[model samples]
Target: MNFSGKIEYWEQSTNGTWSLFAVNPSDNFSVYNFCGKFGSCNLNDNKLPCKCLPGFMPHVPQKWYSGDFSDGCTKNLMSCGDTFLNLKMMNIGRKPEQSHQVGNETECKELCLKNCDCSYTYDEKSCLIWTQELVNLQEEYVEGYNLSIRVAISDIEPTVQNCEPCGTNMIPYPLSTSSNCGDPMYFSFNCNTTSGQVSFKALGGTYRVASIYQNTSKFFIQVMDVGSLRLNQSLPFNLTTPRNSSSNVSSRVTDDVEIVWEPPLEPLCNLPADCKD
Candidate 1:
């Protein structure tokens, strides 16, 4: 059932072995610390986890001593002049209620500065600032992204909530990733969610992103290319794996995502008859 190296072919007439190796491995560069999970804690738990962000002090250090990081390593929310200090390449975190991404260190700071709700950052790539209490904090496993939350600044970005992307010459992509329906291309955000951010009702539709929003109120969605999307139509599409193909996805959205299709796996691209003209 398994190959030894590279899979050359799969034929019913003959049995052959196939093996695979990953050319790009992120595992070689992983750094984990319990303090990062504590949010306030540094690398070692030995130090007091109650330390506040730079330019601020703890609201109640005694409570944090009792394993209550929920006190949120308090900071001076009233501070006006405080800006972000970029810890280069440091691993920051993603907020559950907030949406953001990593951009240039200066842009990350500016992004937070634009919004009074945004305050600080811990890393250049994975920046983290705080306006509210930093709770349920955990060490982010994926290549962390940076975000300056808020200290006390006016709206930074051109958008109202500082929600729109701040930097990147070609338009920075959102971390909320998914594949483009019908095209088999992965998409993070397009015209849809951008519209939704302004008006909650604008985006929830037959599109896969809307499909997820309809079921889960959490509002985290990225339409993937795992299904055939019938434009302007609402119909249940079944995802099936080919006879021996490992790619497959279940129709039920709640179940694990099926690896419905692969690019090279499909027959060599022959244009649909209508496109030939």
Candidate 2:
């Protein structure tokens, strides 16, 4: 049972989402003390199976042993700056079969440095952004796609990589609540605090929405009646957030989100924190 190996599980990056299982036995993966615990690894693996990103390091090392590496690594003792990129299970041997073989790893960095719009780079593919925001960042194995994050110059050795945040896509949103039905009806929204991109869906059915507000990374709504809620004629719509690793979109409202749903009123207002009706 000493089967071990690092498998590429591209959950978010490219390919929509393809799950790859680690612990390859036929592939010659060896046995290690604790492997594949961080991502999807096995107990027996030769390489550094589980590891934190550049800006991050091991959190609870003991928990990491059992594979509970959720609280991966904390930010390194360096401020946000530039640092040489670090390459892991990349070009050396792994890559997406459906990926476009652009070039070598060096070429990847060359591309990132070439475009000012490029917010972040990974998988040997440069995410050339016409706009800002590098959202939806996930980890996986790809040929020639080792990513060295833009850490504080203090993180890496003097001769290593260097980088800094463009500070463009870090948007913010505020929450708010309003009341309508004679102190009984309430409305509120919270921006989804997810990076890169996100899809927003209205909770209730058709309701008369009066506003689709946006504040920093928060979404505000001033709907009228509880008949039909929509971004426009569309009930239960979706709002895809930006594609930045550090982006959040939440629905906000005033103390009691001022909601004027038509027809049958609503239930969210039942909570005392929401309304008094």
Candidate 3:
């Protein structure tokens, strides 16, 4: 069958009727169906289908804006420091260049840091490290593993504490349950206990806080009916897409998305005396 400007494969039904099977670009099975190397594809994002991972910029900006991600992305800042940003629920469709058996996550982190060539690392049952340029790293909305990418230390903001508790979820300093609790620049969360189950609004939508990273100021949240949630791009938080596309599924399932809010990078005036030029 011909669809738009592309040809698609079709199958004949029992009644001898032809039905569309797959088409290039639109079909999920096609090569480069998702994003290209280092470019993440979000089907929900009608305006921007592909985006570069944090701390990286499109290698060929002109081509990327024209919907060509074959060149992928390049690191915005080249110098690697002690800090690494954790991008959770990522589908990296390749094997690590090196694998190690580490006792704990801390050891896994240290191993990756010591190697200047290491660009990514993962710790589950064991530690896996990648010493080459990361590619085909897709952000998954459903199930996936965390990929820590080496970043410059200047990019990270120090963690702070303020509020106490909203059920089991701890309200960190920058994020508060009350106006008096957190920074006014950031919004407040409303904790509802009417159902005897604690739940709060991360920004505009309701979610159950799964985990909080104090150092990174990131939250792992589980939201129901994610399809209905319209994400606001102006907000500081970042949302992950479902790992596997459920476009054809009739029923919806609960999934977790990582929400991270980082305060703007500190100004040059805020830098320490010795660190300044």
lDDT tens digits, residue span 146-227, model 2: 3344444444332211111111111111112212221121123222222111122355442212222223223323333323
Model 1's C-alpha root-mean-square deviation from the true structure amounts to 20.6
Q: Total clashing residue pairs per candidate? A: 30, 74, 7
**Comparing candidate 2 with candidate 3, which one achieves the higher TM-score?**
3
Order of quality (lDDT): 3, 1, 2
Best by TM-score: 3
lDDT of each: 0.32, 0.32, 0.57
Candidate 2: 10-residue stretch with minimal lDDT: 165-174
| Regions of model 3 farther than 4 Å from truth | 1-7, 13-17, 24-30, 156-183, 188-277
Query: Which model is ahead, 2 or 3, in terms of lDDT?
Result: 3
Highest lDDT scorer: 3
Positional deviation of residue 168's Cα in model 1 after best superposition, in angstroms: 27
How would you order the candidates by TM-score, starting with the best?
A: 3, 1, 2
- Per-residue lDDT of 137-199 in model 1, one digit per residue for the tens? 322223533334443322122112112321110111111232312222223234332212211
Alpha-carbon TM-score of each model against the true structure: 0.29, 0.27, 0.56
